[model samples]
Target: MASPPPHALIIPYPAQGHVIPLMELAHAMVDRGFIVTFVNSEFNHARVVAAMSPSSSPGNNGVGGLDRIRLVAVPDGMEPGEDRNNLVRLTILMTEFMAPAVEELIHRSGEEDGEEKITCMVTDYNVGTWAVDVARRTGIRSAAVWPASAAVMATLLSFNKLIEDDIIDAEHGSAMGKETFKLSPEMPEMQSAHLAWNCVGDHDQQATLFKYLVKGVLAVDQCEFFICNSFHAAEPGAFSLFPKLLPIGPLLTGERGGDKAVGHLWQPEDAECISWLDAQPEPGSVVYVAFGSFTMFDRRQFQELALGLELCGRPFLWVVRPDIGYGKVHDYPDGFLDRVVGESGGTGRGKLVSWAPQQRVLAHPSVGCFVSHCGWNSTMEGVRNGVPFLAWPYFADQFVNQVYISDVWKVGLKAVKDEEAGVITKEHIADRVEVLMGDAGIRERVEELKKAAHESIQDGGSSHGNFDKFVEAMKQA
Candidate 1:
């Protein structure tokens, strides 16, 4: 038999945003004739399969075309029914739990009677370190896939320097929440406030997470290659900072042409959000709001945001996960939802749901603006769809992403914060929303950015060409 095309193993951290991009990359590899095996945590496998069954119609037919792509679930060191408190703890578990499982999988996959001898492995940057010893033991090549913008990666690479300069530290009195510090000069016009807040905590747990992040990057440097889910033209200055990083994305572009064939790692409920948008009078007339899969706001912040949206007097689709904050069903300001619906004249102008189809919503003609947490995936999706943003970044490099969205691209506007408390007020939210959606000059600038984002991913475009080159490299390797 002709030697089975080089077998490759693809592993992604289990969260929603992380899983989706890795799935896209795996699909790309499969299309290029690689024998791919996608590994997931045992807990996540159950969730994904449950989400994929036909009964789960809204889900992307979980594992539909995955026949060629073997699915493997390894233990993540958590006992069944572990709490999974929050993003921070879960991330640490991902690193600590993944190493042995990956090593075991490699050995099993390379057996003489196995489906194929593993030749290469690709994993997310967060989990890349776990694959290092495994790849070395199995004599297979490995690459790190950074699912964020190059700017974020550049900031991460400079963490050691930030620590050394005494700008941030693990000491009890370290300069964390202070406004005086600034990001390294090496970073592109970024401020200290934009750094991932987790990196600044004084506690050991937080400090350890930063240490682990640094170690992960160093381990990635030892890998054969590095990949980022970004287009060259979108952040040329940032891309140039990393000599080994490859910008190969806008991966959601193909799906933009109204193709429903693209797989959704998280199957969303098909609510009437789209139908509501369809009834709107003009294209690009609605505001789309979602704070990704893991963000949460305090009750006061949530109430203010609700008031702001109502004050804007615009049609909107909002996703509010049940467990968004403090692990309880969020209670919006009393009578707030009723008032917004009343103001819209009951044409279903505001569709609030636990979750909605995000990519589809962004691509819809009625979505003129996006209010987002500035997570990298959501940011790319908004840019690709040509929708401007109202940035309300939560933790992580989301703050830096806001700088890119507002200061660099000038397509989006930031919410004004209280000068003393730094909390964004509802009035500030309302004012910025009006400026982005109503001002002629602001609209024109946003449209121009839309054009640039589109050009960056077209054929012969920076992202497209890089994708082609990436496949060629994988094949040659």
Candidate 2:
């Protein structure tokens, strides 16, 4: 009889953004005949299962090649009703507690028979090296997966080096009296004050997160392979700087084979938004706006946004999470919803859903420009589809991504906020949308990038070759 397929354990940091890409990676692995143990925190596992289509069972089985992926849940070391949004707390709980839980899992998995014994572990890089330690203690191979842009990982990896050079504050990794700077001349420039960790919380919180970031740097020394969800053509400077970062992604579901990706972490309102997109005008007519899972805004900012969309006088699709304002209710400007939704169905003005199947929405023909919070997956999707962007960076590595989208790629424009109100005004939004949609040069540039993204994933192309190499390495394990 033929040998059974290799078993691989995959774990992601417990956040919607982090889980989704790794789930894509899991799908990619299953496509290659690897049976996977897909791990989620107890909290997220429930959320993921709940969000899945009704026919999908909670664990152990899936459709298509996904049948090989077994869903497993471990506690996040967080209690029910605790704040999962606290980055520093999550990091501490994950590193200190999750390591032991995963170690126990590895041991039990090895006790299995035949090829069902796990050959390897692939974990989110942001989880620090604790997951790596689990693999080490259990005597199997492990690979660190960076779900964000290669540029962001480069920044994280370079934090200590920047500290040693005194280019940034050693204690905090912030800029030394500068607004923005690049790690190297050829790379994109980023705000020093907006260092990824600095965007999360106050001084104490920033310091705590930075400490874990330092541990993440140490993770590089302990981990085996460092895989990134980016393509070489997408960020040549980042690949050139960090040769160790294997570029096997921009891993869209359309590019992969198998069941739909396993991580939604929320119910996807795909039917409504997609049907709405179909009814819209021709290519490049509708504006697509989403701030991703975590970007939140206050009442004033929300009203300003609604008013801005109305003022654009263009068709739009907006995804608004229920808890977007963190349990606080928001009231739109007078007649805002009536204007958009009432006329939207008839004239293709506006459609709002709590959550959307983002990849499918971006792939739609009518999506002309993206008004985004600059999350890497959304950034990659927009780039892949050749859509222009109005970059609205909220925090963390998103600021750096905005730089790449606007300054480096030249395919998007940044939505500059008012200094006085500290919010992007309605007029600013409407005007930027008009400029972005009307810019011939921006459209042409994004078209070229879209072609690059396409070519890289084809046979013997850069990404294809890299994925083949990674698969081969796993086979060796």
Candidate 3:
């Protein structure tokens, strides 16, 4: 009989944005003849299975190659039905509560007979030092994966220096009066006001997040090899900082020549949106708008966004989930949907859904520009599809990503925010959308990045070679 394929266990932080790319990595491994087991928190495992179950929606089938890959779960030490969306709560749960359960799972898998013994582990960047220690104690080969941009990782890794220079407080809030600081001459410039954890919540919460990030960086320092879901050519300066870092990404679900197996926590509304795109009059004429799974906007911001898309008078597909505005209903401006979508549905001005098949939306030929919250996955998806963006960053690494997209990459434009209210108004959104849609130069740059992303994953390319090297190292270990 043939020797059993190498077994690997993949763990992702249990959030939608984090799970999506990590699932892409899992699929990539399975295609390479590895037996992959994907482990999620009990909460997310149910979410995934429920969202992908045949009964949920006809379109919501499981990930591609599902028969070959195993799905498993471990308790996250939360009371049943507790909210997993709170980042601070998740940090505490993963580090303080879930580590023992995860370690036990890792240990028990190795004790199993035959081909089921785990040969390696792929862990989320925030899984903490305990995971690395577990791998060492158990003798399993391991690597860390950062789902965000490499540039953001590079910045966070240098948080200690920022502390030493007094540019930011070590234990308290941001340093006074310094709006911007550069980590290094090569790193992209950063605004202190836009620091991932800055001003997110009250003082205690902000401090907790800062401490969590620092712990993650220290944990990353212990890992032998680190992987980022980004193309090498895209962020040269950022990649130069960490010698062990590997860049083999823009890791799209469809890139491996397999059927796209998107891991959506919420089921997409359906093929109606795709059909709508097909009916658009011109190629690259439709605008695609999605702000990712997180990010809650206030009532005023929501109204402004609705009016802005209508004001632009472009054919568009917008995904607006009910959960987008805290625990409140998403109340769009009065008569907004009516004005945009006529009764006949023949005018084809706009189509809206609670959720979207984003990769599919970006891949469509009618998609000219993207209005986005600039989540890392969305940024890469836009790049993969050659779609330029009108960046409307919400928070966290999104602000950092906006700098790269608009300033460094020059493939997108950042939306201007109102000075006092701190929201991007209808007028500002309309103007930026017009600028993005009309600019041939922006379109050309995005196409170039798209080609570069595609090329990196081809035979003998940088990403391909790096992935080959990674697999070999695992086998040899």
Question: Among these predicted structures, which one has the highest lDDT?
Answer: 2
Order of candidates by lDDT, top first? 2, 3, 1
Most TM-score-accurate candidate:
2
lDDT by residue (tens digit), candidate 3, 44-154: 877776656343343433353255467777877777867666777777777666677767777777465554778788888877456676677778888889988888887
Residue by residue across 250-345, what tens digits does model 2's lDDT show? 788322343254577766655678888888758779999998888888888888888898899989998878774532333767776666777454
Residue-wise C-alpha lDDT for candidate 1, range 315-395, written one tens digit per residue: 887777766362243367787766675545345467676666678888899988899999888898888777889998877
Ranking by TM-score: 2, 3, 1
Q: What is the alpha-carbon lDDT for the whole of candidate 3? A: 0.78
lDDT for model 1: 0.72
Pairs of residues clashing in candidate 3: none
Look at candidate 2 and tell me the lDDT of residue 440.
Answer: 98
Comparing 1 with 3 on TM-score, the higher-scoring candidate is: 3
The CA lDDT at 235 in model 2 is 89
